[model samples]
Target: MSVTVCLGSQFGDEGKGKLVDILANNANLCCRAQGGNNAGHTIVANGKTFDFHILPSGLINPKCINLVGSGCVVHVPSFFKELEALEKHGLNTTERIFISDRAHVVFDLHQLVDGLEEAELANSFIGTTRKGIGPTYSTKMTRSGVRIADIFDPEIFESKLRRLAHGFQRRFGELLKYDLEAEISRYKNYREKLVPYVIDQIPMLNSAKEQKMDILVEGANAIMLDIDYGTYPFVTSSNTGLGGVLTGLNLGWRSIKEVIGVVKAYTTRVGSGPFPSEQLNEIGDKLQGVGQEVGVTTGRKRRCGWLDLVIIKYSHDVNDYTSLNLTKLDVLDDFEEIKVATGYSFQGQKLESFPANPETLAKVDVTYETLPGWKIPTTGAKYFYDLPVNARKYVEFIEKAVGVKIRWIGVGPGRENMISR
Candidate 1:
């Protein structure tokens, strides 16, 4: 079983798409395990760019079959929209793409409740994509969700929509009443487009495993957004970590032999959460500006900070990460000095182990280890040794800090920019 899994190591936007696109060329299949259209992965190829929300980045690879597995909460409209865009750009879903029949559908009520609930939170919204992700998962937890197969059942579809709308109406009536009738009309129209691609993904996925085809499990959000492992109340509803794969794909953890955690050269987080190593300074401003770090899904400015080795190691320790792919090394070209948070000082006491308690996590103070910046353009570097000495040193520091082998480094924006060490 040649299986590989890729996930975000930080708060996300870790350039996972580019790396996935690169690795997808060698793999026969790519499976998206969790989350929904709330996250975006930007992949550039053939001098054109593709922004993926539902489709795996590997969908752009002609030889790789992309599967949306049972764990994902899909926005059918967004999935079709992205498909249209990819097809318009010469990449079609073809017969290789599969959508799990077990996957929950992001219905109109999901969107209405997602947006309306955030509006209700006002000061405390969890910074969701408002693309109906939270609501889709909510329906699944409550066992009232519509699935990919539900689209074909007209009566069941109508009935579920009515039930879900009523649930939302009670929660959001005074806040933002949903246009239930209009939503029904819109989704009835949407079902026409989704019918061709929506499918029972589990059988196809497991069959591929039986045939020993190269299957990859791709995650939607970063590890920091994982519901159980991440910062609670501020976390994404689904699991972004590796454990989600076991449930999302209905596969045991032992089936996955390689787990590649994608970490950015520096740190960037989107939405609101506890960032233990966030840099609130002139350097932070420069980091954000230089990287043009913004949420592709929500268009919100990303929270920039120093690379947190504490979290990187914690990520590996939690997931049993086998290797690391450091992305956005080119973004460090403009920085004068590079900083990596190697330790944390909590309440005047130093700590090495990852905080098991939420209270301890909230109180931990991050401490840094700085390195001399290379300040040289590295967009064209083809090999690890080709990198400048300072860049190599920074890589070494990270390898030492995280104790994971540095396998590849993403030097630029495109799929081709990735280099193996």
Candidate 2:
């Protein structure tokens, strides 16, 4: 059985969707392990651009079956919206997609709480997408969140939802304004509509394993956004690393064959956090503009910087990536010099590893290794040997530093633009 897991190595937006789309062509089953609509993946194929939030990008490959695993927080309304958009694009989704019955539901109430919580935090907000992901996860952890299976039983669903809403209302007070009965009425209609998509993923995944199908797992947020291992309060609500794939999909560790970590040639983060290598000047602006560093879900301009290998190494320590995909090398074509962060020093002493505290991480000084830029576009290059000498050196430097082979090089945005190394 070949089960490959693809994850973002940096602070997300690492061009994971393109790689997943490419791999899905050979995959029998593709599954989304964690996160929710808060995560976004944009895939360009066949002269069309499709944006995925809650749905698996495997939908791009008609032959591949997609599953929204239990670890995901299902925003029922957003699910229909995404599915309908795919249908409008002439993709037949009927009987091809399924959602785990155990997946927790993200209600409009959670979204409202998300905004309220962010507003309460003010300048110190976690910079979430305000898509109810955090709130839903919080409710899930508290054991009050409603699951997809609960929806099938209206009375149970209503009772649980009301209790959850009441608890939130007590916390947020009048700031928590929502029509509980209206939401209930709305979900009454959703109950029957969602029945066909809900499933017990255990059986499905077990069958895939027994059949030795080529299964591909698409991770949402990157490792740095993982709740436990990432930058703490700034991180996402779920475990966005390898552990998530195992727990979220109900699969054993042995089921995994390859773990591909997707890393960009440069680094970019959307929300507020401690970014050691962040370039807030002309260089940052150029990367932002050329790389189109706006978030697909939040529309916020990503904070750009040099590739930080320190973070990548730390990520590798956790995910144990078998290979790497270096993306967006073309975005660096016009630069005269390119820099990569090799190490971090805090208080004039070199730090051995990534700091757990964002405050300490923010205070650390970055040590960069500069390399001569190719000054030529890599987008036209179709093979590793075809790339400019300096461009190849840049890719090689990253591969050597991370101690991982560069399996795929993304020169441009389209699927065909990727060069297999």
TM-score of each: 0.95, 0.99
What is the per-residue lDDT of model 2 for residues 41-136, given as tens digits with 9 covering 90 to 100? 999999999999999999999999999999999999999999999999989999989999999999999999999999999989999999999999
What does candidate 1's lDDT look like per residue over 1-421, in tens digits?
Answer: 6789999998889988988888888889898889888879998898998998888888888988888889898887788788889999998678867788889988766786777778778987788888888888988998999888887777898898888878777766666566768867777787776666777766776787788887777878888788887777777899899888878886566678899999998898887667877888888888799888988898998989889888888889788889999988998987788878888877899986777666688678777777899989899999888899999999988888778988999888876788897
Q: lDDT values of the candidates? A: 0.84, 0.95
Residue pair clashes in candidate 2: none
lDDT of 1: 0.84
For model 1, give the 10-residue run with minimal summed lDDT. Answer: 171-180
* The candidate that achieves the highest TM-score relative to the unseen native structure: 2
TM-score of model 2 (CA atoms): 0.99
lDDT of 1 at 361: 80
